[model samples]
Target: MRRLASGPDILLLAAVWIVDVAVFSTLLNRSDSPSGLLRAPVVVGYAAVGAAALLLRRSHPVWVFAAVWLHSCAANLLPLGVHPTAGVLVALYTVTASRGEAVGALAMVAGFVPLGLTVAAEVRAAAADERITILTANAIFFTVVGLLVWGLGRWVRANREHARELERRRLAEADAAVAVERRRIARELHDIVAHAVTVMVLQAGGAQQILGTDAARALRTLRQIEDLGREAMGELRRLLLVLRPSAGDEAQQPVDGHQPGLDDVDRLVGTFREASLPVRLGVCGAARRMDRSTDLTAYRVVQEALTNVMKHAGPGTRTRVELNWADALSIRVTDDGGSPPRRASAPSAGHGLLGLQERVDVVGGTLTAGPTRDGGFEVNAALPVPTTEPDRARSGG
Candidate 1:
C-alpha cells in the first residue's frame, strides 16, 4: 500500500506540535491569574487534537485546514495569553501546495475571518483603549506571518510544476528523435536490399542464358553474383550491429570499418556493369574528398538511380553516370530508355526517392529526379563542399 504521508511530513508535524505546545505552556506558566490554571488542561487538549488533525493534512488539506483554523480561533478566545495558530499555518501551507494558488488565497482569507472576529470581540471587551491597540498589533503580526507561509507554498508549487513540464518536453523530444532514426534505418535497408536483389536476379538470368553457349562468361557472371551477395550480407550485418550491439562491440567500429562513399562509387559502377547494364562513368572537374555524410549521400544517389534503371527499364539500357567536382559536387545519372521495354511490377511506395530527397535536404543539398525530354529518366543532385582552411584563408585574402 502507498503511504499517504512521507517521512518529512511526519517530521514537520512533530516540529510544529512541539513548538505549539511549548509556546502555549510557557505563556500559561507566565500568567499568575487563576483563569490560566483553570484553562491550562483545555489548552493542552486543544493542541493535541489540532496535531492529530494535522497528520492528515497532505491527504485532506482543505478539511484539515478548516479544523485547525477553527480550533485555533476557539483556543485564542481563552486566556491562554497567545494565539495557538501553529497548526493553522502548517495546514494553510499544505492547502496551498496541494490545491494551488487560487484555493490557497481563498483558504487564507477564510482563516482570517474567525481570527478577525475573535480579535474584534477581545477589542470590545477591553477595559482600556491601549489594550485594543495591543490586540490589533497581534492581529497584524499573525496576518503577515500567514501571508509569508502561503507565499512560500506558492513558490514551491510553481517550481514543482515547472520541473514537470520540462520532463514532459524532454520525453517528447526523445520519442521524435527515435522515430526519425527508425525512418533513417529503414531507408538504408531499402537501398541495400533493392539494389542487391535487382542485380543478383539479372545476373542469374544472364548466366542461365549463356551457360551452354559461353561457359567462361557464364562462370564470370556467377562469380560476380556471389560477390554482390556477400557484399550485401556484410552491409546488412553492419546495420544489425548498429541496431543491437553487444557490450564488447559497443566500442568497436562497424563490421567493415568503412561505409560506402564517393570513393566506392567506381566499385559500385563496376557491379552494375557486370550485371549487364551499359553504364558510362564521367568526371568533369578536379576530384576532391568530401565529408562522410555528403560522400555517402552521393554514393546512394548514384546507386538508387542505377537500381531503378535496371528494375524499371530492364537490362541492355545505356546509362550515363557523371560527377562534376567544382564549387560543389554535381551528380547526374541519365538512362536512355531501351530494350525489353519496361517490366510491369507492383506499384511502388517510392520510399527510395523520398528517402533520397530527405537525405539531400539534411546535407544542405538539392536533388531532382524526373523523365527527360527524350524517352529516359534522369536524377541530378548538387552536394555542397566544405571549404578547407587553405581555401578559407585564400578567400579571406
Candidate 2:
C-alpha cells in the first residue's frame, strides 16, 4: 500500500514543530533562570506540558493550540512570556495549510485573537518608562513571525497545486496510452480472426461438396481446417489476454504482429480508395526515416486525420494527403468533399482530435485542427523525424 502521508511534506511540518519547541524551551529556561521552575514541581510540570504540546502541535493542532492559549493566560504557572506563545503560531500554520481556505482562515483568526489579547495585557502590566519599548518590541515580533508563517503558507500552497497539476497530467497520459493500446488490439483481432474465418469457411464449403466421392481429398481438407481452427484458437487466446490478461499471464504473452507505421501510408490510402474515397498520398522533402514511436505517431496522425475527414467532410470532396519527410514530419490531410453520397456521425461522437493531440504531444509534436478558408476541415501535425533511417522506411515490406 502507498504510504499515507508523503515523508518530505511531513518532515517540513516536523521542522516547524522543532523550531517552535526550541524557541519556547529557551524562553522558559531563561525566564525561570533566577527563580527557576526547577525550584517548584508544579511550575516545572506546566512548563513541560507547554513544551511537549509544541511538538504535537501539528499532529493534534486544536488541542495543542487550546492548551497553549490557556497556559498563556495562567500566569507564572505557565512557561514564559511571548516566546512560549510561538507554538500557537506553528499550530496555526499547520492548520491553515492542511485545511482548506475556510478552515485555515478561521483557525488563523482563532490563534490571532488570543495572541492580540495576551500582548495587550502585557503592555498594560509594563512600567511607564518601558511601556512604549515593550509594546514596540511585541509589535515587531508579531510582524516578523506573522510574515514568516504567511510566506511559508504561500510556498506550501504553490507546491501543493503544482504537485496536483503534475499528477493530473500523468494520469491523463496513462489513460490515453491505455486507450491507444486497446484500439490497436481491437483492430488486430478484427484483421487476424476475419482472415482466418474466411479461409475456414471456404475450406468447409469445398470439403462438403465432394465428401463421399472424394473421401481422401475431403480428409485432407478437414486436416487443413483443423490446423486453421487451432491457429484461430491461439490467436483468440492471445487477443483475450491482451484485452484482459491475468497478471502472470500478461508477463509471458507474445506481442501482436502489427507494425502499422508511416511507411504503410500508400496501402492505407488504397483502403480509402476501396471504400471509394477520392484520397491522394503525397511525399515531399528528402527521403528520411524514424523510430517505431515517431513512425507510429506519424501514422496515427494520418489515420485520425483521415478518419476525421470521412466523418466530417463531404463524400465527393477530393482529399489531399501530404507527408513531408524533413526536420519535422508534417502531415496535412484535407478534403474537397467526395462524390456519390455524404453522411457522418456527430462531431462529439469522435474522440479522434483528443487522441491525436495526445499522440503528437507525447512525441514533442504540435497539432492544429480547424476549418480552412475554403470551408474544409484541415489537420496539420508537425512531428519530429530522424535523418539516419531512410533505409528502413524505404525497405518497408
Instruction: Write the residue-wise lDDT of candidate 2 on 236-313 in tens digits.
Output: 764564464222111111267565787678888778777667888887766575544556678788877777777766
- The positional error of residue 392 in candidate 1, measured at the CA in angstroms, is 38
| Best-matching candidate per lDDT | 1
- List the candidates' TM-scores in order: 0.52, 0.52
Q: Which residue ranges in model 2 land beyond 4 Å of their true spot?
A: 1-44, 54-59, 73-83, 121-126, 241-397
Cα lDDT tens digits for candidate 1, 323-343: 887788899999876664332
Q: What does candidate 1 score in Cα RMSD to the true structure?
A: 18.0
Q: Clashes in model 2: which pairs?
A: 315-338, 315-339, 316-337, 316-338, 316-339, 317-336, 317-337, 317-338
Clashes of each: 0, 8
- Model 1 lDDT, full chain set: 0.72
Off by over 4 Å in 1: 4-7, 22-35, 74-83, 117-127, 213-397
